[model samples]
Target chain A: MKIICNGTEYEVGQGTTLLHFLAQLQLDPDTVVVECDTEIIRREAYEGTLLAPGQNLELIRFVGGG
Target chain B: MRIMVHEQEREVAAGTPLSEIAASFPGSDLFIVNGCQVSGAYQPREGDGCWCLRKGEMIQEHELRRLLSLRHTPGVQEVISRAVVGIMGLGGLGSAVAGALARIGTGRLILADYDIVDPTNLNRQHFFVDQIGMKKTEALAANLRRMNPYVDLTLHDCRLTAANIPLLFAGADVLVECFDDPVLKAASFRLALTDMKTMGYVGASGMAGFGDNNLITTVAHRPSVFIVGDGESEAKPGQGLMAPRVGIAAHHQANQVLRILLARAGMLMGL
Candidate 1:
């Protein structure tokens, strides 16, 4: 299935969990805030959340510089 | 009738127009009532608060406010003057951001940073050569006070962790993420989006080195969350943080912050 993340579409396994999907992208679940379909998924919910085709995800990572 | 004019109680007629009060002060061109600008024809009731702006005067707090008010229309200046912004770091971005906000008359600033000014920071940070040994919080606070003494400043001289981030910036209407550590940045970003959802957020990323200035930009990742910078450059061996590029990103964060605060108060003017 294809899921939209940060305005880009990515193909993932059929039943990929949000946590597993983050790992595939090489993103630490603790570092990025995931907004799935307009609702913010809690840190703990990343494992239970499932990705469906065409689902919109906004991933905001905190990269540092001042 | 009793009314407070410039914090002093004075007597006026029961239905005296604000214009009459303004006329009492020579060279005055602006008038504020109850924290909002009012037309000269508007009459003041008993105990109404009032302020009259006179030209060529430098009366500390009131004068600073008057000067800022001149640049913005009525309530726009008032909204900015009443805002409280929290800055999380005191480096290149946070220092410049605070300086801009102070000059613009942001009512209160909550500044947090555990670091001290280093000789190496003179390149982009706002500290002077003599301030190298001083704490960044103290040095920045002193500089901000010099820029605008009327602005209220709250300084935290300790390092901020996810556990204390929310409490440190509790009353801030907007939070600007300016940390230099990726770990702290991520922690604060997650909390701002989740726990402190009510406050607006502006964070920076990838502004380092002497690359193309035009490449630096601001992006709205969420409704109230903004990220500024190229999102690519990093400060490494050959590349380092400089004033021009870092300042560009800093002002972007500052400008985005003003946009959020002004929009919240329904006074976002222009584009």
Candidate 2:
């Protein structure tokens, strides 16, 4: 399946959960906010949401500074 | 009964007294029910529009209240005075933003932070030398009250999160995201965009280095999300956050907050 994460297109195994894909990218679930197809996916529901072909995902990672 | 709190609607007991209502809003001293100042013993009536006056703003005579804001034009000041703004973090950006809004006569302020004042924060964050050991909320509220006693300043002594974001920020017309961590900042803005259900939200990003004054801009990520920062200057080991540059970004957030409030009130100039 082809899913775009933060404007970068990536190929992942079919039926991959949003949580699983994020883990493969070395991203922490708590450190970023997830948005799928313009809808914000809550932290707890990331594992339940399955990515489809051509789906758009946005992972916003926040940094630490004033 | 339904009554307007700060600017949002709230429900309470069948005959909730002004005192009880005032207590829910931390640091509020005078309650305004239907545009009239009421005592603590007064009970709210149906469809009453209630709000609080900051400490030391209790004037028995309406004429005196008018005299206090005599310098500001009556037309726009009314809208500004009725506004309630929330500051999520009481650090450099949060403190400056709150102070600016208070000086502009924003009616109520909601401030949250669990951190305490430190000598290092003196360079950028707004705090007095004598306030080093106190909680940020306590120190900031004290300083804000001194700046504008007429502005109700509510303080929360806990670290803010997107959890229950709506309830925590329900009373404000605008919520300013001012956390030190980028992750918290993003989460704060995301909640405002998706969870506010009501009220405007402003956030900062990439306001970390110096010398690109014009680059520190306010960008509208969506119609609902507004960012105030250079969008490129992240603080790294080599680069640093200085007082002047941080001040600029803080004021940018403050100015954008006012703009959002004015636009909502339909009093925006040249719009």
lDDT of each: 0.86, 0.78
TM-score of chain B of 2: 0.73
C-alpha lDDT of residue B45 in model 2: 76
Which residue pairs in candidate 2 collide?
A62-B182, A62-B183, A63-B182
Worst-scoring 10-residue span by lDDT in model 2 chain B: B61-70
RMSD in Å for model 1: 6.9
Against the true structure, whose TM-score is highest? 1
Q: Tens digits of per-residue lDDT for model 2 on B121-216?
A: 898888999999999999988888777676787778987777855677787888888888876877676676677746677888777767678988
**lDDT for position A47 in model 1:** 95
Query: Model 1 misses residue B256 by how many Å?
Result: 1.4
Model 2 residue B233 CA deviation (Å) reads 3.8
Runs of candidate 1 exceeding 4 Å displacement: A14-20, A28-30, A44-55, B1-59, B269-271
